[model samples]
Target: MMQFHDAAKTNRSSGKVARPRLLAAATWAGTVLVLSACGGGGGGDAAPAASAQVPVTLGTAGPGDAQNHLPLAVGHSWQFEGTITEGANSSPTSTTVTIPSTRDVGGATALVLRESVVAGGQTTVIEEALVKDANGVAVLAAADDVLSKALVPYWELRFPLTAGAPFVQLDKTGLDFGEDLDGDGRNELVSLYSSVQVVGVESVTVPFGTFPTAVHVRRVLELTVRRSSDGLAFDATETGDAWFAPSVGWVQRKSELVGMGEKLSSLERLTAYTPGSLGSAGASQGATSTTGSTLATEPAWRRVLRASASAR
Candidate 1:
């Protein structure tokens, strides 16, 4: 929630010096350091081997297609709850959201959410019962911060694929997005614009069932009117092991984020997921089948940032 203030710390405002230090102590961890150790060489790491692009298709997608349900039209609400973890600390969080199924003026959807964060016997709150649109051509509302602001331009683009799209995007402006971990014909979207990376896919065995996960890195930004200079860019990655449920759709997603540097911030295992209440409510559910899903493998990206730029 804190921004990296190179100019602020050097200036004479009220509490600017301690601001950066305080933020570092609370939000900084070993995320960037770990990324550098593994893949942060020369802007980004090497791409996977070359492969063909999966053709986009559409059909009867079930609840498991939640990830692909882009342009989330009007009159839909999803409830979520999870936890955030750092070194020696873990806290619970909850969110209730409503969004338009169609794209608004900017190709974004309108979103309203109520969120609560709890830590150390204290809780912070945020409530938004208003409409917020996106900034893309479709006006599809994507994810945003607590203030209901768009994070990146591509985040505005929604891929309505029956299965995941197999592709990689590398640009110096943001992230080098790429993934095809499962070889199931679908590739994951890894974006660097917000410093969020999809590292790998994970299979988690839980009490109910086993889920195939997409690992992601999410960095919280500092909010400011100046889009270029605002928002804290701390490292936060989550491994989302998402499972397709019969009646309810995708459920039981587990996530985690690790920070870097002296700030010592990190997010442990936070399980945020859609519940089975959809079936219990007697809503006519779709059949469980992999008919419209993709299952092709993508080629490994072997180029550096320059050649990979076209994927952006």
Candidate 2:
């Protein structure tokens, strides 16, 4: 189970709230949001040994190519079951991700993905607009149940996954914290930066099944919180690993967050998946359709942090 720390007692200087509430909330939100999209096992679980490796062939055809490891199509959904642990207490969790429709974002067609996560008896829903191209999959925008505004887009995955090569996923500053912590009547500023690298290929087993050609990707996120009132700042970091199977999306994921004298760890595995159909005609039609507003112009990380705060 994820734990929320008491903001009042976290960092107090002269009886003033040095570290705002959003500091912990943003850290937790970033950790969960970053780790929730992909797949992998628990941090303590290891992949199969070399002797268990299996030979398999993957498709390389267009957007739905198995090599991309993410097949985006409307109506596709994935269900995951897992456990969240903080110290000695643990709680069961479940997540459901679905692609319900398509929209036009940044002159490209993007699929709308809705993810519902139930943890600690609370449900949080996240909606992301994603685009899959030859370059890989990227998020065009994001929104959650708590925030009325949508977040700006960022790269979720890059093409040509290779080990030892790390790419910057997001590096932006002056992001909104979406709350007026410290009773300052003004929202704080936040800086979010992250990088991702493909570790290697491994065979992973979960409730769904055993996948021999799962691509393992590791991501490291660093968040810096700065108070708009007086320039007070603090730092937090989260490390996560995700496994993607050929033609199937994410199979498992593990994440750990540490900061502000708090640590949280979680592991999730694919339990069931239903693939959607996006025939050649449908794909072409999606490209020509211009339905929704471009999502890149909105505030990006602010909504994510706010959503997590509400979850607690």
Best by TM-score: 2
What TM-score would you give candidate 1 relative to the actual structure?
Answer: 0.35
Task: Estimate TM-scores for all models.
Answer: 0.35, 0.70
The positional error of residue 269 in candidate 1, measured at the CA in angstroms, is 10
Off by over 4 Å in 1: 1-75, 100-103, 107-151, 156-250, 261-312
Residue 77 shift from truth in candidate 1, angstroms: 3.7
> How many clashes show up per model?
50, 7
Report how far off residue 247 is in candidate 2 (Å): 0.9
Error of 2 at 58 (Å): 24
Off by over 4 Å in 2: 1-66, 144-151, 279-312
Span of ten consecutive residues with least summed lDDT in model 2? 35-44
lDDT of 2 by residue, 1-312 (tens): 102223343221112232333322221112211211011111112221121111111223434333647767886788999987776789999988777777776565678776777889987666667766656666665553222232245557667766777766655444455565445566655544566778999999999999999988887665545544455555455677888887787889877655545556788899998877662211223433336442221222343333333312
**TM-score between model 2 and native:** 0.70
- The C-alpha RMSD in Å for every predicted model, in order, reads 16.6, 12.3
